[model samples]
Target: MLLKQLSMSAILLYSSSAKSLDCAGLFKDAPTLVQGLKPFVAEIHPANVTFVPVGNPAYPDPVPDLPEFCRFGAEYNTSSTSKFRFEAWLPKSDHWNAFWFKVVLHLFELKIGNGGAAGGVDYREMAIPLAKYGFAVASTDTGHNG
Candidate 1:
């Protein structure tokens, strides 16, 4: 049984690695795909115009010389009134690694809270390190935004 499980794991890993997609190449070659995403892309103020202080206690220190990325939000609808929202950060061609990292945070302690509103300030902070490593990261608010 153990050997079988190991073999299955190896197969899955190999298949995933073999089929990795080059996101930057896809976007560049497919103009229609970029056009379709127009509605979902969020407009971000340039970092130079909207600066967060270095010593702010409420937020994590901003990443210095951060790579350029496209920020976008999407909704998944299961019903007229029920929907889920998520945000994605796609690093530009210069930094893209054709890999994705989804961020999931959970705190079991009673007093600490869930660490601020979902997809709020905390999510962006959490993505910095992953972005530095060239990952395309996505974060969801579970279903509702705070």
Candidate 2:
């Protein structure tokens, strides 16, 4: 059997001030956070950060009554040949419950004899339900770009 592994690492930040932060606002400020974490994070594409609203038409299974959130996407170069990609969903301050959710799905395709594929689509669907309950979610494609 072919084995594949998916791994992810994430960093979550909240404002020090008492002011509420919105999804769009967080997305706009994501670059600043990325820049500050340069020592730890290899690279963060500012252009990849985006706001995903409730019921985004782009998703096949649209989130119903989904809270507004910021989506941060990036690729990490840990080694010469290994690349890790991930996506983080942050709910607005007003919608947040101060909880962090990390979803990782390991799929084994017996028929195809493939293993270790990261099930990002499945985890993305899980985000909708978790967001409804006011949780921040982060998902990773491990290093395989699945």
Candidate 3:
């Protein structure tokens, strides 16, 4: 039984990680990238967006609720080969081009949460808003099952 389990684990890991697509290839055009993300955003809604400051004593505050949304990842296993992936979008003003990319990283923790039922927050709605302001966004599930 132990051998069986170990074999299964090895097979699973190899299959999942090996099937990843070249994610960078999808960013060829900004508009095309944004357009493709629309459906993904619509599927994940009513997400939680919590904000925490760096080097501050304030407990992370949940941003009442923004119009944005995100898709929560679920656990699963599969025999097929693929990788897991997703997208993140945040609104930006004209000036956002200057500092947006850097700031987006800071909010990743708040956006991704813990990847559990109660942890992950949806932010798909951010795609369009981000795109309209000249931000290119995209995501990939990579085809992994779990």
Candidate 4:
């Protein structure tokens, strides 16, 4: 029983980590990316996904040197009239700084909190630089419309 449980754990870990992660491919292939996380996240459905390449000025505003990253947004439909949307930014798979990866051994995940009435995952200021360092950044509007 112990050995069986360990095997299952190993399988889960391996399956969750993308072997060939791609910025654009994530939009069509693995939109949600969240699995085994039920009740709270099972209802998540991809609503908007956009991948912006480096040097392209885009929505909200423009960052001087923002790296190419995947922008994903989803809605959690809890009821007929109750649904909230959130967004996430995943850095390029090549590991922005391969040298840093060789020393750090792993990437990092950063979560930004809602600020005042912003009501959106639009923290590009912080998200962009972290993404350049290969950090996975995520933020939510927290059900507000700002």
TM-score of each: 0.48, 0.54, 0.24, 0.50
Identify the leading candidate in terms of lDDT: 2
Per-residue C-alpha lDDT of model 1 across residues 1-146, encoded as one tens digit per residue: 22222322322232234333333333332224322221233433233233233322334445445455555444444356654444455555456665655553444311112244543324445356445687656554444442
Which stretches in model 4 have alpha-carbon errors above 4 Å? 1-16, 23-25, 28-59, 96-110
Report the C-alpha lDDT of model 4 over 80-103, residue by residue, as the tens digit: 665444444444456433211111
TM-score, candidate 2, is 0.54
What is the C-alpha lDDT profile of model 3 across 39-103, one tens digit per residue?
Answer: 22212233334432222122233334433322212222233453233333322222123212211
Clashes of 2: 2
Global Cα lDDT for candidate 2: 0.44
Poorly placed runs, candidate 3 (over 4 Å): 1-39, 42-79, 94-97, 100-145
**Which is superior by lDDT, 1 or 3?**
1
Instruction: Show the lowest summed lDDT stretch of 10 residues, model 1.
Output: 3-12
Scored by TM-score, the top model is 2
Please report the TM-score between candidate 1 and the true structure.
0.48
Candidate 2 off by > 4 Å: 1-10, 14-18, 22-64, 105-116, 119-123
- What ordering of candidates by lDDT runs from best to worst? 2, 1, 4, 3
What are the runs in model 1 whose C-alpha is more than 4 Å off? 1-39, 43-65, 105-122
